[model samples]
Structure formats: C-alpha cells, structure tokens
Target: MVLKYCLLLFTTLQFIQARKVVDLTHTYDKDVPKYPLGWLGLENFTYFKMDTLAAQFIDEMWIAFKKIEYYEHQGTHIDAPIHFGSGRQTLEEIPPERLIGPGVVIDIRNKVTNNSDYAVTVQDILDHEDEYERIPPNAIVSLNSGWAQKYPNANLIFGTENTSDPTTFHFPGWSVEACEMLLQERQVSVLGVDTPSTDPAQPPIYPCHIYLQTNNVPLLEYIANLDSIPPRGTTIVLGAPKVRGGTGGPTRIFALIDDDQEQEITSNSASRNFMSAIFAFMYLNVFRFC
Candidate 1:
C-alpha cells in the first residue's frame, strides 16, 4: 500500500510538470503602445541592398541590408540599475541568471481598476503571503495590475492624448514603501510590472527605480498580460535585452507552469493575461552561459 501510494504521487507530480508553456509577450509593431505622457513609437526604417545585392535584385541581390534608428528602450524591455544609478552594470554585463528565473505573479488588477495610479503596498504582498516561501530568492517578481486597457489605441502608449475624459489614461505603479519591501525585505532578483513602469506616474520619475537600485535590485517595465499567471507558483523566464551600455531595453516575457485552465481563462481575469503572454511567444529559451 505504501509503495502504491508513493507511485501514485510521483505520477501526479509528473502530470503536473507536463503542462504547456504560454507566451505573454506582445508583438511589437510600428505602433507599439506607450504611456499617456510618454512619446514612443516605431521609427523610420528601410531595407536595401548594397552594391552586389542591389545589382543582384536589379542585377543580382547579394549585398542586401536592413537599417533603422530606434530607441533600445522600445518594446517589451528590462531596466538595469544603471538605468537610474550613476555607475552600474549595463545590459551586456547583466548575467543570464539575473535576467531569467522562477516567475511569481501577483494579482492586483481589481485594486488598480478602482484607481489607475493605485500603488501596490506591503499589505498587498502580505495579503498573499500564504505562498511567500514559494517565491524563490532569485525569481522575477511580476505584478499584474491590468493597465493595458488604456492602451487599446497605440496613441496612449506614447502617453500623449487629450485629458478631458477621465478614462483617457491610467497607469498602475508600485508604491515607494512596496518597492522597499521587494528590494530591502524580499531581496528579489527583479521586479516586473504589466504597465508602463514599476512606480506610480506622479511628480517623481521612478520611485521604484531609486529604491530598487539603491537596494541593488532591478526593474522591468512595459510588461503586459500578468493577469493569467497564478498569484504564485509560476516560474518566470526573463529574456534580457542585447544592449551594450544602455539603461533599459525591451523584453519578451512569459510565464511557465501549471495553471488551472478554468480559473486562468474564465474565473481569474489576471491569470488570463499571463496565459495570453504564453500564447504570444511560443519559443521560450533557457539560459546559455559561455
């Protein structure tokens, strides 16, 4: 009986591990969204063939190339301590372990809907602390606060629009205290948010940036579709940007692990977002060290 029970348990765990992976990344088009006050969009780019390539197309088609000028911070990206720190590691210097890890998603969409700028507090983290021990130390902490509705129109992604209507714009950011909690107390590897930034859009630029950097933590912004991940348990893989000394670069994000399809799709709107992310980018990559 004991042997039989152990075999059954192992089989169940294996079944759970066999679940599929979902891509939670948004395809960056010429009109990738931005914040209500921010100015960002695709740039002028062209693909042309050089001497031999042009000659090949007209004559041959060999020396061909594509070129454009754009910001490294465009699209889904990650923020490094150097983003806010005077002297810190750049994108290239960032380790793959630091970029990717177990991902933890926290659902606060309802709270955010009530107040666009509603800051995530320590209570918010503690409110769901029942699963705190499960959140690994080097994991990527993601906060799902449902700030994507405002970006239905690509114009808002640039953060520039008429403010006459109250629903014109909204952003969910982390509070200074909450930032301290994740940085100083929790000591997470990285803090990710499914919004324009990790801090509230107010008089200050990035409170989370200041605190996290001071505390040796990093931040990832413009992450969408966190609603689909479980409040905990899902492993997060961070795809670091290939920028040299840049402060921040876009990211292709996702959540991996077993999440009840019923709650993720029908019952839990937040989990739906994470599922959406998994659907977007199917090719999930593990870390590579040279």
Candidate 2:
C-alpha cells in the first residue's frame, strides 16, 4: 500500500510540473516592420545577411556560415531607461530577476478598432482591476491592442500614410496617468505593448516614456502574440542580448502557463494527498477486519 501511494504521488507531481510556454516575440528579418522614424528619426532599419556556404565549401565537411546585422532597437525589442538620455540604467544594468514576472494583458482591442490613436487611460486600468483583481506588485503589464495581426505592412502597423513625418502616425499607447498609476501606485516591473512605442505617436511630449524611464521601469515594444496570454496567472520569461553600456536591444519574450491554468493536469496535489490517505485507511481497515 505504501509503495503504491508513493508511486501515485510521484506521478501526480510530475504531471502537474508540465508547463505550457507561449512565444510572445516577433521574428526579425529584412522584411520585419520598423518604427518608421527609426532611432535617430532618420531612415528605416538596415538588416543584412550573407550566406558563405559556397565560398567555404572546400573541405568535405562543407561548413556554412552566415553574417547578420541590425539595429538593437529594431523588431521586437526592449527600451532601456538609458535610451531616453543620461543618468539611467543601461540594458546590462537591469537585474536579471526583473526580466521575469507574472504577466497581465490589458486588452484594448475594442477601443483601438474604433480609434487608432486611442490611449489606454487610468480608468481602463482601474476597470480591469475591478473585473480581474488588482495588478500584482512587480508584475509585467502588457497592452494588447491586437496590432500584432497587422505586421509586414509598415504603413498599416504604424498607421501612417507617409514615413517621412512620424508625427502623422497613429496607434494606441499608455497615457501618462496610466503610467504613473502602474509605476508609482501599483509598482509594476515592466510595461510591454504591441505598438511601436509606449506613448502615442502624435503626443506633443512623450510623457509615458518619461514616466517609465525616470522610474527605471523597462519598456518592451513591438511585442507579438499578446492575445495568447491570459489577463492574469501567467509567468513571463525574457531573453535578450546583454550589450555593455547599450541603450536597448532586441529581446525574445515568452509566457508560461501552469498545469492548472492550461487544464493539462487536473489531478492536483491536494487531491493526490487525500487519495493516499484514503488508500492507507482502506488497507488498515481491511487487515484489522480480516
């Protein structure tokens, strides 16, 4: 009886340990969409790739090598506080522990579909909290505007007829009040969005960027597949290049769902423990009665 109980417990724990990971990053290539104005408000990104397989095919091994280059801020990337200006933490300065946390997806797809320049307001955050508990401390809040489906077309993604003037573009972003509430009041670790930036494209002043940058809160931009993440109860893991003294760089972000959340392993720990107790009781009762 004891041996059987032990095996059952082990199996139950192993089953519960299985987790579901969802890729929330967009692939970067020559055709990847860019932030129209680019880093310095100049031309778009420059990505180059060279395959040297034929050139180095002398030996029987036939080794192949590829060289690639692109801007750190381009594609799905994180914007370090230093990107704004001096006296801030660089990409490397951010602690590795802050890169991962509970994920919260505040969906604004309805508002965005109606108004392209709609900004996520403080009331929206409050409404979300009222519906689904409060945003936990140090959680990573992601703004899902359903913009990931509009990729490959730079014009449509940025909502601009021309790329010369960035001010003409339109997209949903976090308002300054919302940023302050999340940063100062709620104390969230990271702000991620499906849009190209954290602030509205036509804002006279990028208050959202200033609020986050000054507070040392990392900003994730151009994130993809946010629709896959639940409003809560998901863990996010971020992987990015550690560039020394760098302002920002591309990042690979994903979310993890536990067995209970994914409904993969229905047998919980408590259930298994109760079963073990019942088995032991039955075994003892049978022997005593016999």
Best by lDDT: 2
Local accuracy of candidate 1 as per-residue lDDT tens digits, 46-165: 211123223235455455554444455545678777877668777777777787677777788789655767788888888767755545677788787765544436445423365322
In the range 158-255, model 2's lDDT, one tens digit per residue, is 78877556777888889988999898888899998998888877763578888788878889999998877678888999896688988888899988
Q: Which stretches of candidate 2 lie over 4 Å from their true place?
A: 1-17, 38-41, 44-62, 264-290
lDDT of 1 at 113: 57
lDDT of each: 0.64, 0.80
Instruction: State TM-scores per candidate.
Output: 0.69, 0.81
Off by over 4 Å in 1: 1-19, 34-65, 131-134, 152-169, 259-290
Most accurate candidate by TM-score? 2
